[model samples]
Target: MSPNVKSNLRVASASGSVTDRRHAFADLAKNEDVHFIVGDWMSEYNMTTRGGGKVDSNGGSEEFETSFTEAFLPALPYLESKNIKVAVNAGASDTKKLYDLVVREIRARELNLNVAWVGGDEIFDVVKKAAADGSDFRSLTTGKLLSEWECDPIYAQCYLGGFGIAEAFKRGANIVLCGRVADASPTIGCAAYYFGWKREEFDKLAHAFVAGHFIECSTYVTGGNFSGFKSLPSPALSLGFPIVEMEASGEFEVTMQQDRDGIVTVETCKAQLLYEIQGPYYYNSDVVAILDKIKIKQVGTNRVRVTNVGSIKPPPTTKVGLTAKGGFQAEAHYFVCGLDIEEKAAMLESQVRVALDETKYHCLKFRVNGRCPEDPYTQDAATVDVRIFAQSRDESALSINNFFRPVTDTIMQSYPGATFAVDARQAIAKPYYEYWVTLLPQSSVKHVCYIPSKGLEISIPPPTDTQDFLYEQETYETNAPIDLTALNPTTRAPLGNVVHARSGDKGSDCNVGFFVRNADEWDWLRSLLTVEKVRTLLGGDDTGKPIFRFELPNIWAVHFLLKDHLDRGVASSSTYDVLGKNLAEYLRSKWVDIPNKFLDRGRI
Candidate 1:
């Protein structure tokens, strides 16, 4: 009845504050079929008040409770009167409070309403209990103890699956609030419960997952960042949250509320859908849905029919990203001018160092940018901006700021043609954060799986051992075992260019690599990365000698580990063109038939 009540459903996401709720409520009131009013009230910054800290790897804190109390207080009357349900994850840092508030709010009003509260991975108590029960909190990626990282943890929550909310819906909760659930859960829950989709029916879940991805960031999908977005019918009033019309047969159309100010055009929504998604492997706890096969059909100005969604078995583990305490860092900026010129600027900077040597700093570093003698002669003469950085533990890092005042005066008086190109200022340097990649052993985390309306809760079996999971992958029907021998490496004469590939700072724990390609031959390049090449690239030999290769999805990638090949320098820098000249020369000599176009298109 719910899925069929209308061909499409539109949910509205707006501020939980009373003032903002009025704007959304007014829009919802006009649309009789708009099924849900959604709110996002829990972000990391807001959760600290409710005894939740920035460390909650799940998005935001249980601060959803505060948002709930504020928005529901004003919108309840309008929501109930309009027969529209509300779904939100405003329970920021506190799940228990969030659960209690919604339960009590509905019951206090004497309404037997379906208000569901989804719990998250905020398991401080669970971890304590497990520890008391002699359990270990070892890092999955590194076999290190949790205590070794010195993380200032305020919260630790597991990312919840969408199936849990469907269970809550079965219990008749009209509204749903989740803790750190994936942004797509609401869409998945609505589709599975409303349409009665099953486990074997993965296509429907994939459809719902993608629909959620399109609208998860709210207005972004509605025309916010659309490259070709034209004038909206009503820019001020038309933008709203999204909805999916999923059916038993696994077909769905994404649309928003009608009769609003503006339009929800196909081009706009498609742009948002594709924005920020890294590639074909769309991941979640229980499903790894591929986005390549999905088709978007523009039926009208504001609607797109989504079809041909393909689904695959999810990875056994989910990656958790926690921002932890990693000491303090600070930076100071100063502008050194060259009047009689570049040589003068360098001398002035050297004089300031003599002044700094008198002071005690735990650690210090200096970098000179803009108008140095070694710099290219693009500028008329030479003027340089020198930035000095100092870092230490919390207390010591504060000392570096003191140097700013004295250094400013010394440069103006002592150095020739020395004027402050930019005034010297001091600022706090945030910590160099690190990420540790660890698998949540299936034994530790549980997956409670279910189908629509079945009331049967089936726990997905744990994956076989890690080695088995890695080695036993059966190639999907759409993909075949690629024949590597038929493929020929494109060789070219060395173009005398060098490219340097290095790991992103955060990639200290994870393996970050890159490959080369010629700019024009980017299309159809990914097909060249066969299973054999992937295995070879990702594989390790007994000697611990690193072997590297790349698969071309769209770009002809010559992937290799940064540590292995980049001890001296990477083939390229993050800014691809920096080494273009060097790379052209290198590829010409060592490579053959290399897809020139594939390698060229990945220039960032």
Candidate 2:
């Protein structure tokens, strides 16, 4: 390990979607100087869905792994020529399988790439034994025990850190495949291995950790899913993925391919920094990243430097995402247009209820989307989608054709201009599952790195200390209220006009973080957006739900976590905004008073 020479580790995110993004892989592979290329292809929902079939039987499926291999095969020659190392957690439930496939492909092509697989993230047997031994496996969202779970889990896997990936790289493995390491583990692992960052180098590790967090979702920090996407100079469709250039001092600059579309500015970086994080302290298996004191600056045309990252102690336990076959769900959508949209939806609901047996389903919901225009100027303006969703434990009762037949049958006699959104036959019942997110003792997980070429296996241990590093909530004094009457003139505009926000979901809960561009606007933002004010912004959505507000004075940001906001998370949620990606935009659309002085500064 060379500590004297500062390493400029350039890592790029190749894939970010749950499914295959072969184009992204091809795009990142074009950069010959990239040392590490990472891809994130797993999510809790997809894990359960992909693992539903029999393991070793005729019905067994490895479609997820197969899709990745097919998409990634195109970049093999380029990667080998450039000697670029690849790290990805595309192996949702089967890392070994993916490793074998890659090795086979390399041998078939006569390539010299060394492949490795990191496992031990899967803890199904451990969890099963614990359950039999009367372990509660309490729910993180609701404090209820796992004993109350309606069905047995499909599988249980813990979130491992970057050490295992680092070990693989240390063992001379050029391409490392992982099962369920933290999303940023590949980037962190590569950086750690290249710079020889020890466990004790918490500050340096924390900076890499934050950098990993920023680019884990690929183009998210590059204006792909940004709230101010409309104002961005580049078109969102062809946006470039993020690349991080890490310095030994722990500071890093986030940039993207020059030929690709997208801009990396302070606003975009700050927006992604606040994405999905709970509070000032962000926890991972490797270290607790204290992000309250971080700073962002646009140093170049498309480069933003993130510095001053601090760290606290690591956690004693790692989080385990448990998925169980909850039940079967079937849904159908009917488009309603013209006058009395609400009346048309209610009438359709009444007719469907009389036709279908309600007792056969365990859960049922009817949701109406969009609104009828007072004076229609376009066909879309007068249209609203009415969806009927039904879930049941008995598969036969929730059969697609049988469950949705009632809705389809009524189309002939329903309200005027009523029709199905798509082919009604496409409404098929499929298995939906509940995601139980809980923590497991770090010592229980055995992380191993295996290099197939040398047949070498290395064991990665957890932190020596077992003390919990759970962050103690800090008490923040609220800023004094601003005298709105003192301002000369105020314009009633959307909060998003001056305030930029980023929001995402954490299982059943969701967090939305708001930040300002200027320091003077920070005071007004802080004073204007109190807990009460935020609750008002949520409108009826906050009914009976708990909302906690946090302030990060150093970064001039205020974050709020809405509990149980997402019905049952992404997979099973009946809500249209499954991942809560639109929650910030929804809040931003709400009108609020903005000071004329702040607006005059060209912050529109």
Candidate 3:
């Protein structure tokens, strides 16, 4: 253990996103003896729609997460009584508003709780001026210049680190709200402040960063988004929020409430560790976490211990997301029932294509989802959905009459057993935002901590000792490649029968990570699940997209990153699986030859 810390610091997760259950903070405050309650409220897509972001064009009432405000207010007295602090990025855009509102509430309640906020995340005007000054705004993904982008930029926000939050806590603030500090930074700030950790404590800091990430999604580490859903009781029940007990030694234990229906295991922890990461190097403004040598294991019931998380200095540049008006989109679904599913879908698509002015729209697509079995027992099972999805920059081109009716009008003239799903909700074109993530020099960010009690806005200095390296994954080869011919009898089965996976979207790219329970299967898994295999499993979605694959042998897992998978960001995506949440399930469903012996061992 680091000599500076005397005991373990307990940090509990309160909320995952803006829409996550509000009872989390109160529940944790009433039940757990935690020093800090940290949670994240923002997703990349959330910014595109919420206040002070893309919504600037459209009038927004409050311009912050009001639901989270309600959740935090009720827990204030309990938190103050227990001397528990809160560190969160719930200040989606306007931290000043959030700070004022929170401070008002605290004073109104006659509570002595102090309030602080971190800002300088908003850099819309700065970026615009820099861009106009001939500074290259190149795309991190395609390496194309920002000038080439069809969409005009409106808002730009840099991802801040935890230093500001740490400063807030150090300055005697009970609550630290942030705008766009990286999601896990709240946990990093809490652990750092409690341990009195310095900037040079990369190893310890990296572990806290990962620990924050594990429980950042609240119940994710507690088997909420876990692949072994069926293995736990009450799989569909609302899970208890996660709490991480951190030590100065850079090790932490993840666990949830005993009464709630959620399980904390090694598998669940691994699942969250692999989620939404672009590569092995997790870049943060404070410290870049290296997951290559990380270790996780179930130490006790409802407890999983994570250790040995490696780290390097912060990347000189951090992610900066810029959002712009992408335009409008609307879709109408037509359910074709019973026989001739393919023929009916083809006929509908052909008619819809001719009826709609494809040239006027940015993307006009007809997608056919699912299929009717040779003889489906029920009507629901026998139906297939044919969707006419439309997107256009011009509002007039995507009006209900232009976009919706063109597809719905063709229903009577085309296909049999045609019942279309179109209503006032789906008929109108809703505006969407295009999001792009790129790297900006950390020096450019004006990140600061505002301590209301002290009336100070202390600017945080970017790390001086930083490394410059391409964000990449290193392949792990712990054992010799398995010879398929010598393996157990092969059977055609869903890959999920043995391998379990977790998949999520990071910007336009998708990350899918697969793991196994048995140690022996680790070698086979790394050797079997390659980039080519991932591409093949993805089918049309692959489309020669660049894929980065790596192995996490310590966790018995192989991870694949499919780039440019989502058609732009989720806010403007035309794909049905906009968030790529189902990528793992879709990949697992693909028939693959698996060893009978492993199958006999039972599926994940």
Tell me which of candidates 2 and 3 scores higher on lDDT.
3
lDDT of 2 by residue, 1-604 (tens): 3323565888998777676457778667866468889988877677666555433233355534566776688889888888888999988787887788888899999988999999998888888887788777776665567888677887788899998999888888889998888888898898889888888788888899999998998888888777767777745558888899999877899999767778888888888888888777888888888887888888999899999888876888888888877788888999988899889999999988888888988788889988987899998888899989888888888675578677688888888887986776536877788787788888889899998689788889998754485533443536676776666488998888888899998778788999988898787887888778888998977855667677776677888877778887887888889888889989988998888988787654
Tens-digit lDDT track for model 3 on 451-548?
96898989999888999847555644335767865676799999988888999997888888999999977777877877777778878777696788
**TM-scores of all predicted structures:** 0.60, 0.94, 0.97
Model 3: which ten-residue window has the lowest total lDDT?
51-60
Off by over 4 Å in 1: 1-26, 29-32, 39-73, 100-114, 124-154, 226-240, 259-267, 329-391, 400-437, 442-604
Best candidate (score: lDDT) = 3
- Residue-level lDDT for 101 in candidate 1: 71
Best of the candidates, TM-score: 3
What lDDT does the true structure give each of the candidates? Answer: 0.48, 0.81, 0.84
Candidate 1 lDDT, tens digit per residue, 33-92? 666655555432233233334343354543445535654655565666677666665665
Model 3, residue 38: distance off in Å is 0.5
Error of 1 at 601 (Å): 20
